[model samples]
Target: MFVSTPRTEASILHADLDSFYASVEQRDDSSLRGRPVIVGGGVVLAASYEAKAFGIRTPMNGRDALRLCPQAVVVHPRFSAYSDASKAVFEIFRDTTPLVEGISIDEAFLDVGGLRRIAGPAADIGQRLRERVRDEVGLPITVGIASTKFLAKVASAVAKPDGLLLVPPGGELKFLHPLPVERLCGVGAVTARKLHDHGIRTIGEMADVGETVLVSMLGGGAGRHLHDLSWARDPRPVHVGRRRRSIGSQRALGRRPKSAEDIDAIVVGIVERLGKRLRAAHRVSRTVVLRMRFDDFTRATRSHTLYESTARNDAILGVARRLVAGATPMIGERGLTLIGLSLTNLENDDAVQLALPFDADANGALDVTIDSLRDRFGTAAVTRAVLLGRDQGMVVPMLPD
Candidate 1:
């Protein structure tokens, strides 16, 4: 490869961990290395590259996966271990650069433009980052460096399984034009099929066509977006944040089937935790979203947006319950595997007028009272009537209120 300094420099780096959960399994147990490993039995959580070679994929049914690679070893998910690994990897990212934007626990975008004088070029920083993660965390990670976040992400995908790739600033089109249209973000199976019908297969072909023509073929938003992306005109920045776009919690159920009462208790546990977090952070949300995964390896999401935002547990739970109830038929048909709740459309609690001091119904005083009591004593000290003497699903990652 001819490495050169173009008219402009590549300064954005996208770093992603490879097969995070399965890799963690390999790192801890020597027996799992060099062999195919599958995490999660009912549904695949993560599959090692060796297992992936045999066509095993995450979220696939374990039965189908075993049918493909019967020799593969299946391991239950240890979220605590995975969470610790994610934290360590993220710490390395923060140490590597202050301008780190975490997209997920396992991946981030690092802006290294101003660090050239201090930490060498972006390419050098990326290489050092990979070495540090591999040596310190005992995990293989891939990094891609480019002028734009989109290009950087693409470069990283091209250099997978512990590799580094740098796309020079002026040569982004040269690197992207020949790749399939599916490589572009937002081009799922349906959009790809539509493009395939139009005989447009690569980004270069998209670049050759006019945006107006594309609009005629694929509607306005998709047309304009794809046209700009084909020419490498992405201007979206890597956003850094404290409060996320959404806060959510999920629990996986094994093969055992549960009654409607069992499911409602699970919902209560999730909303109880989320409601406390929302108010503690001084935030309010207008949307309650329910995410469900079925035994058939399919997933569905239902959401309800309230006319007004609230941080009250009863308000949020009312909407969450309705959303879940609406999906009961699908749940019965597909069989339940995982359930989760997320609060979205969030804003500062002050968006609505703060209630007068000690107002119970309007400002959720009872909820606040419960929070204080739990803080003083243990969470088990106070409980809702419905949750009394029941074993709700464990709240992983999030502390109980």
Candidate 2:
């Protein structure tokens, strides 16, 4: 674990949108102003700040969000529009600095260390970036300026919803010490509860526990990680040209007890779509991961590494089916409510080796042919039988990629 040393020089900047999807909807339709807005049907995909004030959040049930804010307006997702807006905002970042590392569609870490003479100081650059995004893209963005990537991220989180924050040199500890322990990266509910039980509720308290005690309490990796962050220490550089390493999808089925057949069908649909995306990107995945959320909200993940990397839908779906089967006992006891699929261990298309001798290439060839057809036509032109009538439509625009 490494703690970042505060420096007078600010180079890294993190930019993030404020209630991105909801904000976009509000911007497009002025009538939604000051009213709660929910952006999904089955799930409360994204909620406006107004809805959030009413205790609504993402991954929540749409029905519950409506109950919280009965006057809230619901809207379906607009992916193409969001993607266009993202491209426009990213263009602004690129214009300012060449070393912009995108974390998601709406957030990125910009390294402007080499732009002092040309683009002014980091603080000024951040201000300009925010204004540009608002004026050109019609969305509000918050920015955090710091000397390191971790501090920049923390700074951005602190200054959200159309705000800007700068952590000056030698002020890192002062800014971090009083924050809740749960605010630290990787300190989820489980870790926060554990820390609170030990009377370590704040970052400063965690720091006082010392590295040795944290290691003993939280185990080597997690303990060391918390200890380092407690001191406002992070050394990750803002690197450019970072490519996505995985493609995945998840669906929340609320508290409903879906049957094994239903779960299998959903998992198959997710894997099929994900495999198509992998092939579109000219990549192959050697690992498949299955994530499940039970009706009681307890979550578990199972993963399997394939004998070789491949982008075929059948191969990926086969592994996913096996993972779902293995989790059947747990599902029987708790009842499954949500399912997810992710393909990892990715490699470039050129890196994939052909299948071994005696294996039929028909399936692979058919997958490629299907992909080409979909590329020429639309995504709707090709759909799995399970997904044919499942036109719930996109509930909310995901963070643009």
Candidate 3:
């Protein structure tokens, strides 16, 4: 059974770029090699491996990161350059498999189940992928081959920077068991603390606790999800053509206490950007999700579903303002460390049968015209009143589609 399982597990491969954005920066700039590089201003967008060694991480405040790695060389992120590199790497991925599901700009799941005859084997494909990414794209990537998405992702994480790891099917338990519970997706700080209180410290310990107990402990949705992942039995397919349901952005404000007006301004900026993206995509969002992270790293998200889907900034910002108000009482003196805005429940405009009875076509047309101007001239050409001065001259971080 064990020998048969090893053969079955080699079909799924997860490819993850090493320290993607920072790596690109290091590769493009010869002077940045072997030194700590931190990208982004006001906050740490992404840090190089050297900076990471000093405990600097993404989404951290720039000041904190600088404090952590005093010798870190800070560089502004070049999204255009990163995008070009990503496109090249993805093109290589397509050459290897017809079924590649991108999880982010830096990582993807490739299903080479039917490529045995041509590609040789999963290990061969992984090696070729690493070589192509290195030789052609000028970047280092890590590849992990396993039977399931969960294990594949875990394997890739284990083989970071530039490496390859393969987990055989029957070896899932052995591969996963000793890992910290935090290694399991969705088990963030809060979840980890909750599980720790229950004496669950590792994936193996979580598995030993039984599914029924976990469900009772963490609620039906998260409990069942984590329990299954603890056993490395994910059944998700490597799907392609998966359109994103949400477009969102977040800014970290550090540990300082921000005034309500300050936070509102940030939210407005996010909503404005989100609205532009929606209009450009010709899609409307039916739901708005507001995520807030506090100084102590505790986070909360509140969402509201609109009666009608629209890409109008007025509509989205209006709801976002209300959601912020609702969350203000929770803010307290600790202040907000991070603010995020996301639009979800998305559908194409063609699917929108008609505009709302209360909405005027004039407003929709105006939005389309504005989007066209911004798209051509750039996002800063046209801006809302709330976003003015709040622009901070910092470019938003781009996420992988």
Candidate 4:
């Protein structure tokens, strides 16, 4: 006689801080308690739950946010304070489990599979983790427990604003099916529109439509991706110390109109910073992408793949400028509000063929020299003429490289 073994229990916990930046502000200032707070003047960086109740959201124009919540208190971002709070919260996460995988400064996926023998059930562990974050860090955090990372992330999203939810081991589909199709990963605005047009309003509905039809509608990769997730088939583990695949930075250009020169300068500043970061991480990129957000809240992206991977700032900037110039027509029609840059298709520097004397990156020597100076002195020790006398923009905190 043959017997079937029991499946693994739900042990993945996705913990995400509740309105991280806004919560930090409320925690530090008693007077701000229960008040609608928006933490940015130009673009809404973060909005407290109180503010969110009034339809305020991040990346929305601050003026529009104020129009929505007339009583909302506007405050400039304190990136340093948010960073400190994130560090403190991460410390708490590390103390909870050695199997913590940080997704970002404000969120992480923790695997507590074997810890149940000592720490009790995954649900209990998640509850305790939330309590610890609340009591120690003085920040509200939501935790989702499930057998898979995808389900855990979805559960956390559903249980937002300091809440916890668990999808029992055999009940993944029951918990997932009723949710809207937009809940699935990779189902963005465009994909969601397509799914909705097909009358696939829920995860269960999408699943019933079957993979073949989905593939035709959403293309091969994305169609297959959603089909797998609808039935809770994600196999990604909580990766610890994961290296980032891409390094990117963006500047929020306020409602004010920007000239082509102004946009180019911002692109240069962003690329300069990203280049230094890429080299510092000992990584090279083969693709450069330029992202633009319009006043109408729509976004467009253009990318160019290089003949070879390189981390030289000038080389990356050249590609970025070309991408931006190509998008110039769209920017003119829509009116640009934000511009960002990303270097992707990354590989370890060790994989790069050593440059010969004749084929070396012309700026490679200068790039390394400037990086060294910045490391010994400060980042401000080196400067580019285009970036000079311009706001470099705030350095948003990120997970470990």
Q: Which candidate comes out best when scored by TM-score?
A: 2
Which portions of model 4 miss their true places by more than 4 Å? 1-7, 254-256, 295-298, 359-363, 375-377
Give the runs in model 3 whose Cα sits over 4 Å from its true position: 1-8, 255-261, 332-334, 356-363, 396-401
RMSD (CA, angstroms), candidate 2: 3.0
Worst 10 residues of 4 by lDDT: 1-10
lDDT of each: 0.86, 0.82, 0.84, 0.88
What does candidate 2's lDDT look like per residue over 302-335, in tens digits?
9999988988889898999999899899999998
Tens-place lDDT digits, model 4, residues 1-401: 11112236898889999989999999999999999999988778899999999999988888999999999998778888988999998898888888788888999988888787899999999999999888988999999988888999999999998999999989999999999998998998889999889899999999999999999998999889999998899877777777888888988887688999899999988888899898888899999988889999899889999998998988899999999889989999999988999889999899888655565655388899999999999988988887789887888878756
Best by lDDT: 4
**Residues 1-401, candidate 1, lDDT per residue (tens digit)?**
11112224688899999998899999999999999999987778899999999999977889999999999999988889888988899889989877778887788888877788899988899999999999999999999999888899999999998899999878999999999999999898888899889899999998888799888888999999999999988776655554566789887876689789889998999999899888888889989999999998678999989988889999899998899899999988888989999999989888786555555487787898898888899788899888998876544443211
Flag the better candidate by lDDT, 1 or 3: 1
TM-score of each: 0.84, 0.93, 0.90, 0.91
Clashing pairs in 4: none
